[model samples]
Target: MEPATPLMNDETETLSRMTPVEAFLATPASNVRSETPQDPEHQYLWRCFPDHVWSQRVRDTSSWVWDFGYDIQNLNGSRRWVCKRCIQNKSPRPRSFAEKGIQNANAHLFKGHGIWAPAEATKSAAQRKAEKMKTKDQRSIADVMKLDTRLPREQEIANSLVKSFDRKHFQRLLLEWIIEENHSFSICEQGRLRQIFEYLNPLVKITDASITRKTIRHRILSAYESHKGKVIAALKQSSGLIHVSFDGWKSGNRHSLYGIACFFRDENSQPRKLVLGVPELRTRHFGHNIAAEILDVLDAYGIQDRIGYFTLDNTESNNKAMEVIGGELGFVGSTRRGRCFGHTLNLSAKALLFGHNVEAFEEQRSDQLTYLLRSIQRSEFEMSSDPRIKARKPLDLIIDNDTRWLSQLYMIRRALTLRPFVEQLVLKHRQQWEQDNRSRRTGNLRKSAKEPQICLEENQLTTNDWDVLDHLARLLGFYEDAVKTLEGDGQQRRRKRGWVGSYGNVWEVIQGFEFLLEVLEDYKKLASEIPDAEHFRININLGWEKLNKYYSRLDETPIYYTALALHPAFRWGYFENEWKDNAEWVTKAKQMVREVWEREYRHLQIVRNSVADEPVAKRQRKYYNPFQAYCERTRTVSGCIVVGGWGQ
Candidate 1:
């Protein structure tokens, strides 16, 4: 059937004489081509038609169509409309009044398009089809508006669906929030949060059923369990050896927390470091207790047998802990226990900075100055209230806190900066004492024995003393750089390994040890240039001796040399050059590398066992050349190339 004909101006004039359906059927289609593209603000009536037909309908047709199903009356020459037949369509006859103005025009447009149905409504297929057409027309007019407010409201309703709630999403958000800001559980307990959530979205309930700290924690634990499975699977897939590191600290509550972290290359050859656990130690901090804790964590994750190197600080306790673990896990060989090179460097520097009875000297100086200042004050040269004395000077001498790392460096640097102010304090005390005491009568003001003053000469920091402090500071700078280079992050190491964390493997540690000795030997010659060089010379010698002891320990551990030799670019060539001066040591290193292969390579062991019945000399020859054949085989089978040479 043809679409209804449009009502002309004559028909509109005769509308009172006709039925509402007749008026609507006779209404003309719009000739409403936008002078500009339709303005969404003014296209309230245009939305009843689909885009294919919107421009073909009349602007007033919307009013005629509304009158078909609703009662529209003129109130003070303005239209007032109500859907009297709302119940007939099986839609809610809302007691609420809908403005006959543009405030709710988009909603009416949406309803007319059949894209949206009210919660209470059911309609015929024909009515739904007509509604869809009208809805398309409405959207064409809305396209030009800067903002379409309806989209968000509709999305909000969709997102707030209870059955659609995602536990994973909540956990992800909670984890991100905790990591970024360290928020506590109290954020969930706030009453205003509920109110704020309600204001933002009433449909999404934030009651105990949905979001609580306990639920957040549960979700996080669930995610942790899932991640643990993935990590274990990845570890099993990768052939690379796993490195374990321990960093322990005591909380303010005196509870010991041991942080165990692991590093390994994944199947795709990406380097990854995952923190395994940080369990609090409630038992007595004995070697066995610490070792048991570490074993439990590793066994729980099923990676106890996979560990290649266990890196830890060089502490007596750690030494004991390693021994205990070695006994239980059969990590008897030297290569299994890896001492932190960074920690060794720290110890060497600490010995020089603090091992010279420096604390006693500092205390003596402090006591002498205190007594002299008090004596001068009692003699009537009172300068305590003086503005000049009260003014800020370079920070006062900061006593070294032995427990803190690098505290010696800070103390020395701060003392040097405040040297001028300290000298001034001493001079004022000395000069004032002379002037005040000279004017006193035969009988002097008596002071207690506890307050006895010492001569300025005894407490003074001479030119030679200042030279010692300056030289010490210069010496510390070398170790500071070494520590930072050895302990820096992997990203920096990737860019320039020598200046970053180069001590990740054994060969680098040996190289660093050799470098320190050479530098110390050279420094001894240079030390003669400074006054009081003997103190530093002795300390340097001590550090060299300590470093040498650890350097010798590397001989027993072949993996250090093994890791270096495995790199295709280096092979045995690097070690040959490094130890060329010591021919005996070089031969020993080569032999140890061969021995490590016989002990660790599973396939090589199988081959050795198979050929055991052969002649002894022939077997020895075959084993002697095992590394070269192994390297060649590895290259052929895996197609793995050395991306870079051994890090300097």
Candidate 2:
């Protein structure tokens, strides 16, 4: 290959010595050898390189002719030798075409980018169109006074409407027409007219649907009451014994009032509840007035001399009322007064033991016990595995302090059952008290003089306090006897070294038992001396027996044992049922009583098994062996089992 000639141009010579296209083609890939031109004004320069020869055309080609021997003049004038290989290898130059012009470019960009614009523009355009469509006429006829011109005519129309629908006159005319024609009228039809007139007429306010129904019913009832003679004639055909139970108490607001509930045994011997009466007795004068009001009510019900019994709480006013009625009515033989046993027991217990002082003492004790029990229960819950405080629920330890003396008895019973846990709590309490006392003493060592007395008054027992304690003691005694009576024959069989019956407790049982015995003796004396009034006097001996059975039966269950111990009526019902059967004037009465007693005795045995430990069981076995031996020793006595042969 010949030495390559460098291609040059005016701009290329001034700047980096090569034009951009020339530098690109001349580097290595373009192989140019010589220059030629196919057009008159242009020339092609061919330069040979290692890979290929690139050709470029030059414009001026007149004077200089090199020894390569090509005719420059001939090549310059539209006839030239071209590097056909270079021309074939080179890519075609891109044509300079007009893109979008500046304004067109911007418009095209804006249109392509406007995705949200159509939605926004359409919304705004629609709003503007709607605003334009809502134009109103400012000088319309509505602006003129149509109301002022038509007021008198409208008033006349309203007056005509009201006159045409005169409700009161219409009702009266309808009633007269019905009476004259002897025709029945439907309330549903007639009542709708009243409703419509009330709704439309401006002067009348419509009654609510509920109020309208109530008023119509009241009117109908009033019409029926005008014919009261018919009601009395019907009542006379169905007469039976009337039962009245009355109770009186002072309310929380300090109002002394009496509540009377009347019931009656119908001809079928079934009890029916009647009207309950509440008469306001303002003064002593009103007492008689109250009585008269009660009598009037009874008479209205057509009750004459068929009253069986009047049950009332033991109140002086109630007794006086009974006396007044019996004397005035000349039906003294028909009226019988009986005191309610439940109310009497409640009142008697409250009057004796559950007075203010005793109650306050109980409250204090209960609070302290509750705090201690809760603390122990919490500790037990935390130490899940601790056997000493084994996770007993706090409710199981909670003492019910609402009742009079019963709650205390319940607490005592619980203490006996949970003696180990309770003992721990008592010890903890003693330690806390001792620590407090020691702290007080330590404080005293720092002071030179003794503390001054806060007041001159020394605490003295009030009569009320003494009375309360006495009453509580009496009730405690009753409970003690009840416990003893229940364990009568069973005690010897079940007695162990440390075991205590309900009456053998350290606090209340010993003294209470002695007191109960004395009370029983007094009751026996009273019953014998006043045989006529024996039924009137309260018999607590029977009450004790009933309570014992209840508590003994309760021993079988963990939850109710303490409750049964405290409640004196658990087995009272059973005893009463048995007693009633025994007293019945029937051939099978004795057999019935025996059956009840046997069932109850079996239940008691079950409870005893549940409560008794090994020692108790051993003692029970030993004691019962003799009874069994005695039974075997003799034949039956008087058609009953002979134990030690009591029957002659």
Candidate 3:
């Protein structure tokens, strides 16, 4: 490409060539004055050259001119010049010196920057020698490996390195590092990390000592105190009657009686179970005194006024206690007292078997059966490994002292079911006992010597004991009859098949047995005419009457009646056996009950509604303002108010 011409020869030359006297008229139409050339070609060339070629040339010359004071330009159709003085003053432009300084200063930072370094003789002899010395001073990977290989010889070094770190301290350090690096950790993440550290670190043990427990307890107390304000606020917002269920039970040691009060909302939409009170009952206190102490607990929880009913197991002391409380609270009749269903069932069972000679027999048979079974168990254990005898412990062995009688009954029933096994056990024990007696007489010690000595005395199996066993068998048969009766009596097969009828049978069986006991007591004289003879039965008719009266009264109670009506075991028969027999009477009774309940409920509602509306109605008076009423109630005498002004 041909060299381009200069747009301007020089600043001085261009200025001198211009006519100074001519008016310098600058207009948007033309960039030049009238005296200067305004050719379209020249104007276009000037604009293009300045934007493209002239701008590039100026940029290229700027660094050398500004820094080194040297400038050079092309010499062709365009006039250009170079400054020799500027070039000479630049001192060889310092290319080699600047490069060497930068490389040396950045050596540590840039050593690994390049993909590869030149292997040519670019370095001076002194630089090469210095580099060699630096490499010699530094340890190589092979040298370090050799040094590590010598570590086994230093016992002290190994001991120092093996010193165990305190896990908690290390964990703290790690947490601090994490916090320092990340600024903050979320509560959940912090807890997770804490658990992880606790699991992994041996030295950071979780202390559950008494001191820790006390500390936790104190913290909980503090939290509860903090929440007390909120709890009170919630209580104020809630409306309705609060019902409380209070129960007291003696602890295993009987040293203290603990009372638990559960609060709940009643059918009238009231909150309950808000407070639980526990008080220690002294052993010296009477039943009435214990009841008073319970009242004291109620007072402490601010629950005395809210209590509507008290449910308890059937105990004389409890009933007396309830009587005392009722008198104090002015609650008449049975309004404040209710009996537990579980306790009533037990009482019913006791009542049904009243005046029975079966109880003594049951006790005797139970004792005999226990004695026999335990002897067999001991013998079985001793001869368990004997090759000739396949010894096994009876599944129905009675071990618990408290339930021994029940266990005896269970074992007898089981023996009846597994007749072969029981027969085997009995025969085995009998044979072992015979062998033991023979050995004892002969003065021969046997491996099964730990076995209990069986009593062959005939007096041990008395008439009373046999009578009890026979009665128990009869009771079982009665139970089966009761079940069959229920199954056959119901209107529908499905309904008849339920447990309700059986419960009725259970009640009937108990009453029938009591009646039988009465008959047995009356027929003592006739026992002489019977095949078997025994001791004359003592007249315990008074005891039976008392027992029968106690149970009958219990059955008459409203709570027992309610339970009998509601119990799943009696639901089918309750409407049929009890209510259906007297349907007309029941219908009248139900109508009367409904009328009483409706009247009572309506009266309660009226009272409540009256209480709610009184304040509202009073406030509706012309001069009465609710704000003023509030102020009056709060006893605030002065506040901003408008008087005698309708607009205000």
Candidate 4:
């Protein structure tokens, strides 16, 4: 049977003359040809005539069905119109609106979507006006047109959707708002909040249950699964090597979570950073245990063999982890390990603050902090009469985070600024202590009324201590700026000196080490001349030693020199100018970089085809090299040759 002819000229002309079955109009013939080639952005708007049979894709203006749905064939592989609103809002979503008729689509839209056709809306217009007259915002269409500034086309589409409430879209926006603002999980569970939502839409829970904590959690997890799949697929498609940066952190609940984040050039050649996983660490955090955890994640993503570099905090155990991974994965551990630049600077900062055994000093300070801070806040030992102490700055003290250098700087700086208040606090505590002793000796103090006197001896900041801290904060500021430059946050000014790309890569490490070393050396030499600063000469020397140790360790990896040499911005010229005085160091750096080049790139001499020239394939059959894997993943090798003594 043929599709019913379109009644475009007058849809209602035959309404009075035709039967109810014949009232449905046919899908447009031009649409049959036009809809096959879909717009990339609007691919959901399809008109399918599968098997050359009409599935009743009616385009009747009188029936407002198409406004709230999409052609299901293109949307989700169903050859029918499906309600998009229902799918977004409903927990157990309806698949399609209708396959052979408009009546089902009409019923679903009106019931599930709370949408009314123009004819039905017209019938209830008087009743709707009586129930609630259009408030202060309503005006005549003529008056609205006089003030309307939108283009005619924009105005038409806006007016059509102005009354149409998309419950799913609203719910999604609300969920995002709640999550972004860190709102409580039971925000939507309140009785009043649910009532407000019911009055606002009247269809918030029509197709699904109320949005409870369970619903929110489920939705968030579902989104996580969806995004995880996309990230895995993107990683697979990425031709570049995947570099991973991971660290272990503890939550408030004391749960140890090892967070693994990956960085790689995506399929579009865009740099992408994403957290791959945060697996719980139940076992003791040993080098071998950390390696096993990282290996599990890499194996799950199937990128274990493609590992490029591991950037981790500088620690004995972490270094051991690199060795373990290298032995198992067949790579040079020394060349692949990248000491986190921030942690390198932080070690120097720690050396400057705490002379030696930084951990021991910091741990003891932490234990004393509880009682020390409480004594400072006591009413009888209140610091000063000056309002500035209480009004300006935060009332609490700043504690240093062992991993972050800036925290130590902030702690020292805050202590220096609040010195006067601290002095007054010491005086108050001393007076209170003397009074308590007198009362105890005279037998005038009641046993029930007595309380232990708080002490502030260990916590007092001295004049000499302030002088040392003042200098410490100033010097640590230089390291803070270097950290910013390495993290790519210094891009707003002139292009970062050591950085080459959008985000800082391996190329920035060497130059950053040089800049920070210069600052430390300059300060170390001046420590002898400065008054009250002689006490910290030992601190400045300790910082210098710690920083120089890492600078010297740069030799263990050939990548540092290689990345610096290959950068398009400078190449070997940067090292030539910077290391003009150190000719020996320059020569050694050049030799290391050249070895990598000859071993990887320059060894493969391409020949079009002498019978069949494919050195990459030939090498794969004979033995394995990491260069061969890169060539296979990122480039096609049609011809190649390898000569003896390539590196030599």
Ranking by TM-score: 4, 1, 3, 2
RMSD for all candidates, in order, please: 24.3, 48.6, 36.7, 16.2
Runs off by more than 4 Å, candidate 2: 1-239, 284-293, 296-300, 333-335, 346-369, 381-392, 396-426, 434-648
Alpha-carbon lDDT, every model: 0.56, 0.39, 0.39, 0.62
Tens digit of per-residue lDDT, candidate 3, span 1-648: 224333333323433532221101100011122323444333433332332222113234222112211121223323222222212223222111121132331221112111111233133344456458746755432243233535565544433433554433453455456445753333213556556654563223221101122222233344555775654444444444333445566555464665655444334333334444455665554668767777766654555555555656566677777778767766542544655433443333233333344355332234555556666655666766775455545555423122222333444455454444444555666665667556655666565655443344452444454554444444434333322332233222223222122122222322333343344354544545534433322223333453355444443323333333333444323334434567664344334334434543436644343234332222222213332222223221332132222102
Clashes of 2: 18
What's the TM-score of every candidate structure?
0.53, 0.32, 0.38, 0.57
- lDDT minimum window of 10 residues, candidate 1: 49-58
Off by over 4 Å in 4: 1-221, 236-239, 362-395, 433-437, 440-460, 489-502, 532-534, 568-570, 573-582, 603-648
- lDDT string for model 2 (79-194, tens) is 23222212232213211111122222222212321111121122233334433453431221212212332578755655455465544454445455554675444442456765
lDDT of 1 by residue, 1-648 (tens): 234457566445655443332232223333333434443312322232122222222235343334323322233333433332232222323211223553243244234322222223344455467557745634321232233547996445444454454534643564567647857654764679756744553332332122555444444555677788887887788666788888788866466899999888777556677788887776777777888888878887888777777887766677778778777777773467777776677667766655545445454346556555445434332345766555533244667664555667777887787666556667776555555555356445335312224434766888888888887777666655555545546552433212223334454565566566666677778778876667777877777777777778777567777766776545556555556688777667666766777677735423222334633332221212222233223332332233332221
Best TM-score goes to which candidate? 4
Estimate candidate 1's RMSD in Å.
24.3
- Clashing pairs for predicted structure model 4, backbone only: none
Specify the highest-lDDT model's number. 4
- Tens-digit lDDT string for candidate 4 (1-648): 234345454434424433221222111122222333434212322222222232334455344465445554433433566565543333234446444565677665544433444433332334344235424334433243343526787566445544464655766887897899978767867889877875564444332224555456556766876787778788899865898888998876577889998888877556778788877776788988988888878877888877888888887888888888888888877778888888888888888778788767643243344444445555423465776544443345677776555688888777776566566655765565557656555756544544333344555556667776777888887777667656653122323242135466677687777766776788877787777676588888888889889989888888898887666554666676677799788779878877777765576667553453633332223213322222233221322121242112
Poorest lDDT segment (10 consecutive residues) of candidate 2: 63-72
lDDT of 1: 0.56
Better of 2 and 4 by lDDT: 4
